[model samples]
Target: MANELTISGRIVSVLPLQTGTSKSGHSWQKQEYILDTGGQYPKKVCFSLFGDSITKFPLQVGQDVTVSIDIESREWNNKWYTEVRAWNVTYASQQPQLQAQPPVAQPVPPQPQPAPQPQATGELPF
Candidate 1:
């Protein structure tokens, strides 16, 4: 818990989901996502969700999310590798919902009246 950290950003990409069985014969799954924190100089971070958390957090590109992660480093073959694993993920803020507006009724123009013709005259006047 001491190594836990939180970061918020918009998801730039979603990496392919990885699934395999561990040495203990238990199936595991992991999903990685690239996040971009917009600013004068934006930062990009790659974090992963493991196991059921991957389904619980179901991420998508362009979604703004805040992730709580734990940074871990492990040594393999004399090389140390670091991983940012997200334990919790939530929308940074409530996403705005778009409301459908009712269509406006167009006003109909009034029909023009025809001019009344003068009654027929008996004869032509000088």
Candidate 2:
């Protein structure tokens, strides 16, 4: 079975860290990003990026892109949580062409109206 999932969303935030003990108690770097999927409402997903992958998916806030992720579900504190681990991300600019958008109609300007002329001071000409 394939352990990969794909999702498209905007990058909301990115956090970089360097605090993990190795066998010799050495610190290692870590990076992650939060993606906001614009669905019926909206959904946010967090994923970890490591080493070269982090550089491959250089994220910026409000950037729209597609991510190829690995998903894992775990139970913690009597609640289930889902994590999206991104393996590859493709920038939107590299994607193929989509259909062209319809042209927008320009708004019509209001026509000028003639000023009303005042009637001669209550006089009936015979």
Candidate 1: tens digits of C-alpha lDDT, residues 19-106: 9999999999889999998888999999999988977887877788889989889999999999999999878576533364789999
lDDT tens digits, residue span 6-121, model 2: 88888888876535768997656667888889989999888877666766777777678889888889999999988667888888775333455788999999999987666689
How many angstroms is residue 34 displaced in model 1 relative to the true structure, after the best TM-score fit? Answer: 0.4
Using lDDT as the measure, the top candidate is 1
Clashing pairs in 2: none
The local distance difference test score of each candidate is 0.86, 0.77
How many clashing residue pairs, candidate 1?
A: 0
Clash totals, every prediction: 0, 0
Every model's TM-score: 0.72, 0.58
